[model samples]
Target chain A: MRSLAILDSTLREGEQFIKTFFTLEQRVMIVRLLDRLGVTFIEVPSPVSSPETREAIEAICALNLRSHVVAHVRCVEADVQAALDTGVYGLNLFFGTSNELRSYSHGRKIEQIAHDAVPLIRRIREAGRYVRFSAEDAFRSDLVDLLTVFDAVVDAGVERIGLPDTVGIATPRQVDRLVSLIANRYPNVGIEFHGHNDTGCAIANTISAFEAGADCLDVTVMGIGERNGIASLSGIISQLYIHYPDLLAAYDLTQLVELDQYVADCLNINIPYNMPITAPSAFTHRAGVHTKAVLRNPHAYEILNPTDFGVVRHVDVGSRFTGRYAVGHRAVSLGLQLTSEEIAQLTQALKERAERGSLNDEEVNTFILAWYEEKGSLVWER
Target chain B: MRSLAILDSTLREGEQFIKTFFTLEQRVMIVRLLDRLGVTFIEVPSPVSSPETREAIEAICALNLRSHVVAHVRCVEADVQAALDTGVYGLNLFFGTSNELRSYSHGRKIEQIAHDAVPLIRRIREAGRYVRFSAEDAFRSDLVDLLTVFDAVVDAGVERIGLPDTVGIATPRQVDRLVSLIANRYPNVGIEFHGHNDTGCAIANTISAFEAGADCLDVTVMGIGERNGIASLSGIISQLYIHYPDLLAAYDLTQLVELDQYVADCLNINIPYNMPITAPSAFTHRAGVHTKAVLRNPHAYEILNPTDFGVVRHVDVGSRFTGRYAVGHRAVSLGLQLTSEEIAQLTQALKERAERGSLNDEEVNTFILAWYEEKGSLVWER
Candidate 1:
């Protein structure tokens, strides 16, 4: 496992979804947050889009952060020049290469695309900036043609080559095989994998690409990007930390939820309640079987403690799945105690309320206290 | 392309996320909606879980629809008995088979699992119910052992074998290769792919599995299930409909957004505004360039028209990217004729308001009308 490399694309892809375009100051704050979170790269906007976008990129570039700032651009001379004008540390030059794009969308020959991309990549590198030449639809492109395009860009002095499943079509095995095949053939070429969530395979494909010898991963905060979006930065970071701890350095994982919420607020979008890691319910337990185990040892049901990410654990008593153990634990936390028989009676009442789908935490506590009173074992003064 | 067989797990998996558990009535409504939408299978809950669940499954089984009502059950004789008592049209028999599950969770040997599964499968077959055998964590299990477990279940009269990436570890290529390998070797056995969204590969893996000859694809409404959830029913349906229209038939695609919203409301979960297809912004354009193309031809920026999914195309004039095309389109819609200069002026005002992040639809229209009045274009008599 290699140390995880987080590339924050909030400015580039996340801005695409905002009803209101971000100002220079807002872009500066986002870059600061990315820096605070110790992200490896902060992807700014395509400088060719607008003067405002270019200003925002320049503002981000002015920030004194350890993280590198990169600008996205189409694989053309003007776009490359626009990106260069922002003074970004690195450049991501992308273009459509698949048949769907070449024949149906761009109506350009594959050779023409290579010709347009290679010289621009050489110019960017000659200017002393890092360059990652990307094939926009590499997954759907012919293997021979993809190799030829990458070879041309790499020979033209591009430091890295990125293969993007621009349409979210590639599978993990295909990523692994393609990345490995390319890496093996071109020993000096650095590889980066850019994936999308159109088919929800982004993260899996990214990891497989890493295993296949890719040096870096392209990700976005909350997976905000085109269509169904890309692999989530938080999801990938947490997984890498937990499963491949040896390969990656420690990230400011505790800041993840806060970062997500900030972005959500900025974009005026609601993060789904069940979104992994950041979701309110992700750490909560209500099922009877799960609750029992969780009450015994939270590790039984939780992959990691909620507090690890500075989130609170919620004991939800909203259904028949809510167990006696959870109820008893909550009562104990409230400094109450009950005998076995009283606890069992309280459990039965709770179950009945839950069965009706109307149970709440207060109701469950009320029933527990009433049971304790009836059994003459009430520990509270009241 | 093969016709995609959608196995809707709304009842079995979707119910897991709700704080307010579904009543028998709500379950029936969901089943009816799914049936009307022409899903191939509707997975009802385990009868052993509750009397209400059993009642719901029985009621759905009695419905006169093309969809088969399949009851999900643990691979145990008692669970099978409960399922049989409900008279469900089909059985989804599932069990854990990975070393982690066998050693740490269930403490059962692989041989014991095969032994236990075989008799239950045979009994279900003897009872004349269509049985789908699933090896939980099949993705992590050794290939030989997994094959052994699947072979035994298949030979014991199981109608289909479900290969689940229980931990969401399989890539699309892995899914394709595994399913194709199984299909090639076990020509008589039907293959079903059950995927999770842990690493967010569920949809791609499902499609790959389909291409690899899998007979059924397991999905949940809004992708609700354990952890990060399962493959999204709406997403899979839309992908199949758009990309492989000849593969399936009779689905009322327009009902998709309505059905998804209905389920989200019942589950008390807010649908993310960025959710594909059903999201508010999915068809709404704020970018100047996109709005221009949309005004001339909506298909220029979108593959499927909004009306096709029971949604209206919205031109949101609340971004620096909002241009004259959006203003002109709105003016035309309101039966107003404005000069190019007036449209440009209004567009500039909208962009300014958008820059401040305070723009609204009414304000945009107000500004446009005011601009028309100033230019002597307003005809109040009409």
Candidate 2:
């Protein structure tokens, strides 16, 4: 089977998230954590951005962590030298190729971009470090322009070709086709995908790249990066766990919780409630149909096993539409005994009361206890 | 061009979210708002689920809104009658076909499922209402079994066929292939896609199905539903605005901010920062490279136009990574005159001070004003 390698960019792309500003210590801590998380690589911003940035990269490289440390740098000589000086395992060199970025961000023709990138790639390779040459805003770049750069960089001994959907505008179908085209052209070179989530397709686009033979995928914690960010490590891994479990054999998937928590704490934002696998409701079953089926067998509703991710499934039976099975389960869990008839009646009562809104466990238990009180001197237990 | 329709499932699937419990009036208001937003259909829970659910459906129907109202119901006759009784414009009937659900949720043979569904679908059609037959957990269902049931339902005159990625296991490629297969088999039937975000592919899968000839796409306000929810309305629309503007021409896209805010308020959760379109950070540019380019041309980095969604782009220059151009722009806006040299020096000082954390505008300005004080009695123009 082909490999699906992760290059976590929490320190590089993630630092670009508006709310994030990683300290030197925080950057080191993140690199160490990512190393333990078994990411194939840990990407950091180029050292030239600031003194602390340079120091952080140097400290990270000195850690001798398992994950390779790569610095994302512009296709400029000074930037390349600064990154090389930091002793990163490699450098991710990029030049914007999209007409908009070319006109506004960097005034460079597509032809000239590859020429500039080639010497840098060759120098980095001669320095005994890996290098990836990315045509930034690649999805919008002319296909021929992209291929021309890839050819030049590959010939210059670049180890990987990075295709970034800088604007996050590429559809999964579009990304799949493009990655497949590039993968076919450069069968030996690692193809890395860095997709933004502006369209909420980062995870899908990353998976499409993988399925289409792209070997390396870039991700951040909570998909944190510029604008809507890129694919989250947890989101990507969760989908992989569902369809390609073998790909994650080296991963201690449970540690994702700590990683996610650390990043969320750093940003001072709660993990999005709708985040896959790591969100508050990723494993919570509340709808009657879901709650009933899940109670019968969790597989009936859950694709990702919560326990495997160091999270637990919560079957909330206090909702208006929750079925009698969930209500009975709730009653039993609350140390209340009731006949099937009583459970049905209690379920009806709770459903009606929940019309205004759902009840909490305490409210549900109180109602169940009240119903049970009429039946007998029910002994309440914790 | 083929028509792409929307079926907003906020009332039906969104209410199933653990934190959501729409009161009768709130449900009515949401329905009215969605209708004004120009969604083609509004899906509500089966009227038989709760008294308020039924009342809300009746109230919505009586409003004479342009959007079609549909109720999601089980394949049972009583559920169909309950939906029909609510005067809904259509009924969405579903039965589990996945092995896990077949064995645990509902112990029905594949043969029996269609046999039971066809008669109910026929009855709903005879009632002169639109009828949709959804194969629940379509992704995991045996293809032959799903096709067999689809054949029976289509033969029974079903207006639409829903392929729900129940438990959110389907990849975009898989959904595309499956939706294409079904769409080709029944060319006249409207194909609906209802994908869950358990693995963060919901938005991509929904768009994939649409691209693959699925006519109807289901979306919630924030993709809120059971578990991690489904595709968000704003997320789907943002991607469409970027790549398939024609598909969304019939809708008022700017109103998405209100829709997202309403749902977030109802759920008592913040709009996720990574959410596209309506998210607070969606248009906030902070990275120096991004801020510089965006100030030069917003399109350089942004795919979705913020103003199109009634949101403004914010170029924050207070952070360490912000470029000198942003600082200069801030200086200009703050009515401070600084030469290029002065701006660069101030930029350096600010970058050094911001290593501990990003400074607010106030803090950045304090340093800016202090630098100005040293230069001269520079009449700071606001």
Candidate 3:
């Protein structure tokens, strides 16, 4: 697990997100953030895409970052030549293999694709750049075609091969089986997983690929890419932290939240509230049962420790569904002392008031204080 | 596979999301949406949580919606009694079986829990309401203790046994094995999966459980829950649509986007950008390679058809990553007549201009037209 590496594609695949247009400077900043997080590779757009993209790749490469700067390029001559000119650390060359892509998108024969990638792979390697060949839509491609292309590319000096769920149709089991078969076939070669989120299994698929012996995985900030995007940087990190914490020791986990925030801001998109580890409410606890359990031990309901990521836990005691335990905990934190019976009574009264309308934080505290004075006196009279 | 059931917990677990405070009217509207979407079960917060929750459950029950209204309740006397009083269709009874939860959260031994749930299960069944016994944090609970509690509840006529990854720590393979083991043990009993997204494996776990013979799955509108949330309703639907399209024919797929939006609005949270079928950009395409393929045939890169969800495909042609094919597609769609060579020149010029700043839709069209007139004449002269 510790040998597994990450390729953060926020600069390359992320540029395909509907709203993303990372200015050259922003691209540089993103690379810096990726380097700080200790990602093994930072994939940028192919220089052939545009003049600024070429400049951005050069600028990022010039930064002398620890992470390898890889450029995503087509196997076409112009794209390969442009990538070589950029003098990046690596080149990720891709060609469509699925029948849908072959017949309609690229119109290339299987033999043509298998033979064409050899020289491009050799060219990148000869230029002192690491090379990876991805059979685009590999999940949907013919097994024979995929194996043929892999045989040619591996024979040519490609260091890694990408298994992309280009259409996001593969199930976790399918991904596991496929990646294991391929990883076993080429044990010495690196296998990378690039999954799309169309079916909402990107994180799971990535995990399956890794568990199946794929050494490299592709991720983007907020999973931002074409359509619904791919596996997310924060998402995979949280998953790895849960399953393989030792593997993430080199990563600056604290920088994840800021990195997610920066990309979301740059793209003018919201950090989705369901985004693991980095959402504004990711560490906030609500609901009576959950809040009560969390009050006793945050571990009762939470697996991800907030403090580990430079955040804190917030138990929302103002909800109508809040428990007496949570309410009482809040009261005690505010320096109020109440018996169990008194706490129950106040909690019931608060829920009744909250039924009509929600109470703010100050109101919850004010009500607790006011009830302590009014309801406490009434209880004594009783 | 159409026999598979969906338990939408947006009203129940979603309430635990820190930002969610669904008003009574909003809760009713959400229930209506779920009913219209044809989910088998609509799980709502237990009445014991708050006075308003009791009223909301009753109000939803009064609608006589086609979907079963299930109340998520603790397997305690007060909670069970409150759930029965609400006259909902079913009760999803749960108790902590894990050591941490047993000692700290609820303080119930395994035997006590095993014994206590039988009576509540019998009583709920006696009240003409369906009952489900969910061993909370079942992933962490001892297998023997789970079997014991589940044996008692199953004997007492519980309709379903929920295998909740309550702490979100189970891997997909772990979930699959556990679900298979339990499903094999209780051949007649129904199995449900309630997973949290803390590890970002909720959707995959649910899929694994479903694959391993679990008939029911727990999901929220936006995967919103205590921590980072759970499997998303849209996510499961999208996955099923891909793997088992016949199972989703009964579903009103078009309502998916609206349901997600309605819930996000109620909670004042943004819909996750990677939310499979509901996010604003879920159907948008921007990558040059992707757009080119999609323009030739949407199926080339898209698994989920936009028309199926009442959304249109948006091809973004303003990015520097725009390919000549994409620009040409845009030109043809805009009724501009240009040869391939002219389109290539215009694409090159567009990329050069977009390098400085991204162009808007109108600007992109204007640039294409200007280049076609200015540079097209030059091409003819050459």
lDDT of 1 at B338: 72
DockQ scores of all models, one per candidate = 0.24, 0.77, 0.74
- Per-residue lDDT over B1-382 for candidate 2, one digit per residue giving the tens place of the 0 to 100 score: 7888889999888888888988777788788778878999999889889777788788889999999998899998888988888788999998999898898888999999988998898888888999999999999999999999999999999999999998899888898899989989999899999999999899999999998999899999988898889999988888788778887878887678888888788778899877888888898888787888999999999988887888988887777687898889888888988899988988888788888788877877887888778656654532
The clash count of every prediction, one per candidate, is 6, 1, 0
TM-scores of all candidate predictions against the true structure:
0.84, 0.96, 0.96
Error of 2 at B379 (Å): 14
**What is the interface root-mean-square deviation of candidate 1?**
3.9
Which residues of candidate 3, in runs, are more than 4 Å off? A356-363, A373-382, B360-363, B366-382
As a whole number from 0 to 100, the lDDT of residue A172 in candidate 3 is 82
Check candidate 2 and list the clashing pairs: B335-B381
Candidate 3's residue-wise lDDT over A208-289, tens digit each?
Answer: 9998988999999878888889999988998889888998989988888889999888978778876889988788877777
In TM-score terms, candidate 2 sits at 0.96
Cand. 1 TM to true fold: 0.84
Error of 2 at A137 (Å): 0.6
What tens-digit string does per-residue lDDT give for candidate 3 at B160-222? 899999988888899989999999999998999999888788999998899888999999998
Off by over 4 Å in 2: A377-382, B377-382
The DockQ-based order of candidates, best leading, equals: 2, 3, 1
